[model samples]
Target chain A: MTEELLRLDGVSMQYGTGETRVTALSGIDLTVSRGELVAVMGASGSGKSTLLTVAGGLTTPTSGEVIVEGNWLSQLSPRQLATLRRRSLGFVFQDFNLIPSLTVLENVTLPLELDGFPGKRAKRPGLDALASVELLDKADRYPVDLSGGQQQRVAIARAVVGGRSLILADEPTGALDSTTGEVVLRMLRSRVDAGAGGILVTHDARHAAWADRIVFIRDGRLVDEAQTPPVTTLFEGADR
Target chain B: MSIRQSFLAILDQGACYGYQLRAEFDRRTGSTWPLNIGQIYSTLDRLERDGLVERTEADDSDHVYYAITPTGHDEVAQWLVSPVVRSTAAPRDELAMKLAIAITLPGVDITALIQAQRQATLRNLQELTRAKRAGGDGGAGDDLSWQLVIDSLIFQAEAEVRWLDHSETRLVRAKASGLAEPMPIDETRARRGRPARGGVPIDGKARA
Candidate 1:
């Protein structure tokens, strides 16, 4: 079986119409394996956001294919893609997209509720995911009552509550201070440690430091990948 | 390995302080490597905290003497044979990261990275050389210690520039060879070598 859980084959994404149109992604390809933490880094307008959108099935590519969890994204219907996203993918946005009226617990449980889970049972998973982020105690507080970092943690808890096999965080720590950012990063890293694959998007070198692999992107192209292997004697010699 | 192990490895051979370790590192690497004294002291403190080294009130007044623990001996021996874990922070290693990403990146202009590094290294080399020449031509009494340091920095900077030049040439050749094809994801995989598993290389042979 292919070890890759997500892949893009000759993918291209374009913006605008005809004469003035810009090619956001051109002839791009990428693969992310299970249990790996991959970072997507690029400068502004580099199609990094577009690639993340396509990889998460939030948008479609103009050409080529996106395969997630061994199933071709093109093969799935709109409803199927939506379902796949809910069950298999966890998404963290740059802004903490929690509902203002909802308490932290309610916001996290919303995904499970949308999937037809009963409110009472959904609460259990919501709190569990929150505990993973060390925010379970803040479950009853409204978004307005929480700080920006806390809200992001709530968003993270919501993303992971449904047992997603792949977690997609797009600049998850972009809104927090460095110390808080490190905390958020460690929380994201814990997912991979617990056996889930993750794709982290960040332009900050410091922020991307925790990834097992970092894939650099620019002008819609796959530039390079850095892998972190377990320390061994061979690694020391090779590094030297 | 623990901080104690590192401290013991450095001190077990002889009594030395943080500054001495920095000098020793430069000497062993043929003065082709330099370490910041602050980093050395910080590591030393951690080692001391871990009880790997005992501090002695030395006469130098400028530095403390450190003696290694027995635990340090066993640890260093094991560490020498153990495989080093490649750090994820490699991307932060200014030169290594630049080279690793030089080929695949678009819009980065590898020539620019190389040129910038070359210019900076050359500037430092020239500055140090001038300083050393002035020091040796002596309007003041000779201080061999400071002269040795300036000499070390000059050589190290020269070595760094040469290494960067070699890397640039390799990159240019790789691109000319058409091996720099628009980086396909699969091509990146090929360059990444065999997977972490004990797999053979793409050519059905074991990688040396």
Candidate 2:
């Protein structure tokens, strides 16, 4: 259950130099194990999204190492890093990042297809991913044809499709209403529960409660962390 | 809170014995509020004394039923139409007051306090969410009473977590404004003797 999928060791991210320099991330250490979804919560400009970008191998930290599945990011060449990201990493963003022209199935199959797999071969996995999110019937529909919630579900399917081990979601529900947002979150949670480790960066605490653990970020630093409260006996000491 | 009104309202639907009223409450509220038999009987006794309810004739099965008075029906009707008005005075929340006091003292880790409380509330919210998810999507019955009750709890826990986040931000701002600075007590009001009370100690890094 604790198989490490992603690990960030003393990761620090700084932009620019001299008077214009800014620290977007401080020395940070975090890990996501298979079957665990960790939620990162903070106010705006708190470096939550930067943490995701760094973890997903899109950006290299100024200091410290990012280890995804035991492969140190710093040691990887640009080609190796791109291959790792294409094959091992998945990213779900707030805008549902689907191409306007790509069909839902094509969008989900894009990652596998881009990794040198034939379209016909990737079709099965894409359909299965759609089925997992209960969007199989709408697989042929375009992104513009679906509701905000359905589009987000498609985004989740694309993220966890083809047995991808790690998922990085940045406010995946920001564009939907409360009910639709919950549906999208449930999809993300179900995928994580199926053994895909993930990091959910969100400002909404209600959504963060869905994760097994939640870490608070403040001013580019991890201030505190919490695990799911002991729930053996619900409302144990809370008087009705 | 007004168990009297609840009992009266249920009795308005139909007559019920003490034990039955407890069962009804459990069914209505998804057993969230465990109504013990002793409390049930005591409340029933009070209702009877207040003339809001009266004992009917014993049934053939030897079960005694309490029937609501006409006046009780009026009360139930009034309660249904009236809005629940919360008191304007601040609620007595130990956690809130503790943080209020904790922020004033030096060496106290207010962040830890808020995080701890947020964890506890999130746990509650998770359990409530899990239970709701597990219960529904099964039975066809449209009885949403349990769903509504659980939702109330979920919303409350969520609100509490948001409040903790806000509190942390406010604490940072307060520190920036020098509002959380500690001040030495004035020696001018010093007395020879002091009273013994279990008050917040003036000294010590409690976290340490």
Candidate 3:
């Protein structure tokens, strides 16, 4: 029995029916087990986004299996898939995407409310997640009032609340300054320490440096995957 | 994790000489990481001094092999889940520093620096491509190690060339549109986005 929390078995996703169709993923096989922090990197139009979306169950694959937490996503109904995504998975986008009108607390607790978690009790984990990203002090602030990096932290806080075991961040730091990006990355890295698995999709190798292993994708295929030592500092402008 | 703990973790797997440790580390990582033998020996000496490893002389071997102690085993387990301070020193991490400095100079052309880096990277990429095909090492024992290092370096150099090419284009467009100066934040408020505190501009001389 594999302890893999997420698995993709020979998966392929094709957009459109035929003729003018596009193949987004081809024969993809990947596994991310518990407590792993993996990064997905590829050039533009390399189908990295398709892989992330398919892995997170945002879209069905054209063929093969998408498994999470021991259940194949393809076997589930749409409603059940939605339920699974909401309860078991979290997402951080490049834009930070914190609701401008909501206070940081509200944003963090939004997923919990959607999942019918008791809001009052949810606040504790929400606060802890915020603190993990070093943005606890901004909890009472609105997204409009916070800097881009701070807002991204709030987004991360929302992602990890409710004890969700897997986090999928798509270019989460692309909008921030490098220094702030490093802080957000550290927070994500700490999630592995806190017993959650993460998959980060980014074009930034420096941002990907936080990951324990890097899986490179090119032309909708897994070109290479390699384990790396922990990064103590950002590698954006490395000289050596 | 402490250096001693890291040393023990590497040795607790089995007895190894300095070269063997370096080789194993490189091999396990698919040759993406290379640990120098000198660094391994120095770390072993420190571990021996700390009583975490016992150095036993081996017959007909110039290098002593080290075996981890009981304390070392316990330390390795602790280190597996330890909250390690991300190591700050990587040989190739000047980009973050450059980005941090760019924000300080409100109107300087960051693209200029990116271009310079891209040009240098492309030259290196060409050299590595030639080396990959030439098999210039005469098939030495360490030849594979050199090739692995070169491959990673080539990959990295190509990645950089691609990044700088893209970054410069976007930045050049931004500059042409009168958005050359990056958005600035107060040093105290700029935790991860901006450079080190106090808006220090990295000029050519400064980078040098």
Candidate 4:
């Protein structure tokens, strides 16, 4: 059996109280195990982003329990929670949020450095992540010097650096062209296949088709879940 | 497309012998639908009989060719401008019929049936994707048509995948909500020489 990296049991998040109150999530139960990528698809204002935020332990849920690697998040002190996030989680965003002044290698190594690993010790993993995305040659180049697609690739490199166990991506391909978007998704898929868990928040079905399973959200509730058929079944009867 | 109309459309470009027309048709469609030389000759013969084409002068190789007449040109223009109308009569779609029957039949695994069809559709989608990727520089002559044909196939396969997803969801919902369980057959009605209500005869004719 694969290791379970993340679990949310009946998680619900609400903002404000009384007339202005908003429920961002309602009784959400989700699990992400090693080597699996689950895609969350929904319309705008449907709580997909909130679900990610709560799962990452960036926001405390109003009710219900969130367990990460068998530890209840509510029991962890703020400092311990911060340490857990730094050591176990990675995030990729739609905007390719790399500091314009930082070189690709510096940006990727920043996470490891922030976690108190020596700069010299962080360099090898940073370089490995960049090479995995075929962007090592651009390691010395600044973010502003790269194309939008290349910048996104660098962001991906930063996410998987240091063997982060859980990846949370929100519209990771939203800013790229169709072909470039496919490249980003392919990279994400490869990483998840290599044993990391992932949750991809996207609205595009074609992109979600690459995930192990797709979860549909509506009105802040999971309305459906579809397991993508095996690749063998999907390509059955194909003329090879 | 009607063979009569296809012949006229091809002849509108220039005069061609039956075999040449057959080859052109195959090339333009990416051989998605191959035409037999015999079928092309028969279609040409009918077009000539209807005065839409006439024999042209034999070339140096002594090969007979036919050119489109004014009527044929007008017909081709009309056909091009007209939108294709879908017939109201149900098409003989094997997949649709199989699913419809499976839902009402006993012990048929509807999920498995739908899954098999979805797999086949996805396979077709992959093949079309490969074809599109291999067809580079679609701006070249003849490449444009092939590209468009592949695009049509891709769109169709994507739609099929979407529909299969929808059908599976609906099926699961129906089962969970107790809406799709087969109703018990009335023995009296079965014993009578009468067809069940809501069930159409295979020939589409009313029973006496």
Candidate 5:
């Protein structure tokens, strides 16, 4: 049986109070199992970013339970939550977010090192992640030396390092050209196929096509969801 | 692509009769655009008139083949090397025309029209995506051409979806900023019971 990597039950988030209250999410129930890639699509201010933040344990939902890797986020202590985030979850952002001072390898290994793993211990996993992105040869190169596409690959490597079970990417391809964006998305898809669960927040339908499923949000609510049929089905009735 | 140039290029390969040329064209293109025999014969007749192709000796079954002339070879080569020119005149786009007129006409629910069109475009996008995925594995020898054709269609459908989304956003912004508003119909004139022009009901029946 596949393992459930993340789950949100009756998730709702609101800011302020009374007339000033703004509900960012309302009754959002979602799940991401191992080897699954879910795409969250919506217009700006539709709570896609908030959903990712809540799912990654960076923000606590007002009155709901967020379970990641079998642990309830609300139940974990602040330190425990931080450790969980450092060890179990990985994030990819639109800006590529690599530390300018660090080399590719160092950027990928930073999370492991912050979780108390020694540099020597983190080296293997860091190298493995870089290799997964086909960038092992660029391990020693700093972010400035690489192209935009290569830098995004490095960011992907950092997100998947240390065998993290969940990957949350917010407009991860927003910075790259269409061709480069596809390459980054392909890498993310392969990583998810290798058993990590992922949620991709994007506005592009073409980008969302890479996901196994697409969830559409509107006005802080789940408006629609679609399961992309396998490519085999897509080819049916096509002249051979 | 010009059918005339395509036929010349194909004839450059070898001499072929009209039916054979049509079949070969269909085979090469994966039948994306099937050609009619009459169209093929007419094009061949025109090519012959232009001194680009000549009737070859008849075969055993009396099949008269057409072979590309030296001039035709040059034309084919030139066509292959030349970039297609895009006309500056507006293309006949039904959706664009509809929306263009709809926005100016009173009592037209522009937002609803945009939403409806968006949904239809999205549906087309989904179908095209499925076809693209099915044709993605261009493993077979003949599959590559078909895959490329499907990819082109997929790209076009995706662009349409993007355009629809952009139009919706622009319309919303325009409405929010009061840059676009439904022109108030002359209700007094309508109440006088005069028939509306161009099907726009000036009668209170028309939506605001």
Candidate 6:
């Protein structure tokens, strides 16, 4: 059995109170096992981004537990939580969020350095991550020097760099063309196949189709989950 | 879709035996459409009947070759430039009709149904993606027609998932806004027509 990487139990997030109150998430229970990619899909204002933030520990849920690698997030010290996030969690956003001034290699290794690994010691793993995305040769180049697709590949390299086992991606393909977006998704799939767990939040079903399972959110609650196995029933149903 | 047109187009290039024609079809189309030997013969027979092609005398190996007629060449030329026309009538899609019917029935769980279909469509999309990835540009010899077919299938599946999502969203909004109540058959209709005319003239029972 695959080890569980992350779990959200009865997770709910709220903003404000009374007249200004907004519930961004409600009693969401989810898990991302190692070697899995779970897609979260929903309409606008359905709280997909909120779920990723809560899962990544970027924001604490108003209720319930957020657990990463069997450790309860609420029980950790603030410094410990910061360390855990820096060491274990990675995030990719719609806009390729690389520091414009940093070279690709530096961006990838920054997480490791922040987690207390020496800058020099982080180079090998950072290079390995760049190579994984076929971007090793571009390590010395700045984000502006790369195409939108290449920059996103750099972002992905950063997300999966070192021992970071769980990735949270929110509309990662939203900025690229269809062909480029597919290439990036293929890279993500290869990473998950290489044994990392991920939660991909997307509004487009085409991108979500790359995931091992899909959970649909509605009004801040998970309304459905689908585990797909490259369906043959679609072609079989037609007598042609 | 038009095997006759394809056969003529291929024969326009040169004479070909029935088997050669099938192989040639597979070569160009990347075998997306499989043709049985009998189907090949049947199509050849029709083409021969229409004088679009003529059968040559059988050789010692009993292989019969077909050469395109001048009329066939003319037909091929026309077909090459002509755009295929789609029927204007609304298609009879069972899924859309079923969902339409389901939504009007109070007990049906439309959301569950939509989600199920969305999942199925997405699975097909993934499978198509897997197939495209595995095929890898269909090798170096030629441009892969199979990739185009796969792209079409992917787009269709994506459209299906998008429609399911759209339908579910519309349904949820309609339900919340009190527009989802079940409908009963109207009683004020003429005795003979479909859709039941709501204000047909009657013997004083119903009127406009």
Please give the DockQ score of every candidate, comma-separated: 0.03, 0.37, 0.02, 0.07, 0.17, 0.37
Across residues A8-67, which tens digit of lDDT does each residue of candidate 5 receive? 999999999999999999999999999999989889999999999999999999989999
Q: What digit string (tens of lDDT, one per residue) describes model 2 on residues A1-240?
A: 379999999999999999999999999999999999999988999999999999999999999999999999999999999999988889999999999899999999999999999999999999999999999999999999999999999989888779888999999989899778888888888898888999999998778877888898887999778787555665455556
Task: Kindly give the stretch of ten consecutive residues in candidate 5 chain B with the minimal lDDT sum.
Answer: B195-204
Question: What local lDDT does model 1 show for residue A70?
Answer: 85
Which wins on TM-score, candidate 1 or candidate 2?
Answer: 2
Q: List the candidates ranked by lDDT, beginning with the highest.
A: 6, 2, 5, 4, 3, 1
Model 5 lDDT at residue B59: 92
Error of 6 at B158 (Å): 1.1
Chain B alone, candidate 4, TM-score of 0.83
Estimate, for each residue in A84-109, the C-alpha lDDT of model 6 and write its tens digit.
89888889999999999889999999
What C-alpha lDDT do the candidate models reach, one value each?
A: 0.73, 0.86, 0.74, 0.82, 0.85, 0.88
Write candidate 4's Cα lDDT for A83-187 as tens digits: 889888889999999988888999999889999989899999999999988899999999998988888888888888999879999999999997688678777
Q: Estimate each model's TM-score.
A: 0.56, 0.88, 0.54, 0.61, 0.76, 0.89
Q: Which stretches of candidate 1 lie over 4 Å from their true place?
A: A1-3, A229-240, B1-109, B112-208
Candidate 6: which stretches are off by over 4 Å? A230-239, B12-14, B27-30, B137-143, B176-178, B189-208
State which candidate, 5 or 6, has the greater DockQ: 6
Report residue A157 deviation for candidate 4 (angstroms): 1.0
Q: What is the CA-based DockQ of model 2? A: 0.37
Among the numbered candidates, top DockQ falls to 6
For each candidate, give the interface RMSD after superposing the true interface residues on Cα. 15.6, 2.2, 14.1, 6.8, 5.3, 2.9
Residue A27 displacement (Å), model 1: 1.9
lDDT of 6 by residue, B15-84 (tens): 9999999999978865667788998999999999999999999999999999999999999999999999
> Considering DockQ, which of the candidate structures 1 and 3 is the better prediction for this target?
1
Error of 4 at A148 (Å): 1.1
Per-residue CA lDDT of candidate 1, range A87-157, in tens? 77888998988999989999999988888899999988998999988898899999999988888888878
Give the least accurate 10-residue stretch of model 3 chain A, judged by summed lDDT: A230-239
**If you assessed candidate 2 against the hidden native complex, which CAPRI class would it receive?**
acceptable
For model 4, the local distance difference test gives: 0.82
Error of 5 at A208 (Å): 2.0
